[model samples]
Target: MPDAIWQKSSYSAANNECVEVRADAEAVELRESDAPGLVLKADPSVFADLLRTIKAGELDHHA
Candidate 1:
């Protein structure tokens, strides 16, 4: 996983608190900037679906 470069979301604020993503052919990995050691893994397709859903306002009820 160290081989993949992690990137923060463009929407993230100036503060260090943000989510990060590291992806490759096999899977997409996610972690929080404050706790780099803990990670969450998801298939690329699943990740894409999640992003689409979020953008479509399907999950905004939580906020």
Candidate 2:
């Protein structure tokens, strides 16, 4: 098991939404809040770039 501190997504609503995140020294882990046993790990740098791209409207699907 990874030593991760789990957190729900800010975008998640009060009705038991689906996303969560875990922060570690070098990366962020994403998972389903209801399923704490599963995780998807990502590098911090790549995650940062992904966030930046989302903020910059580079993700057309979100717009």
Candidate 3:
């Protein structure tokens, strides 16, 4: 995590209604912008797959 650079989502606005992400060599870190103290980590590959599923609308819950 030494060289991880945290970035907020592109859709996030000045009101801060999104999470921040940091990617290191091994894993990706995620934390709410309004609550930086709470962090979540996941494998980079798994994270990428989740993002793809989201973009493809494969995990939508509502019609």
Best by TM-score: 1
**Residues 1-63 of candidate 1: C-alpha lDDT, one tens digit per residue:** 678999998877798889999999889999999999999999999999999999999999999
Give lDDT per model, in order.
0.93, 0.80, 0.89
Task: Give the TM-scores of the predictions, in the order they appear.
Answer: 0.88, 0.74, 0.83
Worst 10 residues of 3 by lDDT: 2-11
Candidate 1: list runs displaced more than 4 Å. Answer: none
**Candidate 3 clashing pairs?**
none
TM-score of 1: 0.88
Shift of residue 25 alpha carbon in model 3, Å? 1.8
Q: Please write out the lDDT profile of model 2 over residues 37-61, one tens digit for every residue.
A: 7778889888889989988888988
Model with the higher lDDT, candidate 1 or 2: 1
* Candidate 2 error regions (>4 Å): 61-63
Worst 10 residues of 2 by lDDT: 1-10
- Model 2's lDDT to the true fold? 0.80
Clashes of each: 0, 0, 0
Q: Report model 2's TM-score to 2 decimal places.
A: 0.74
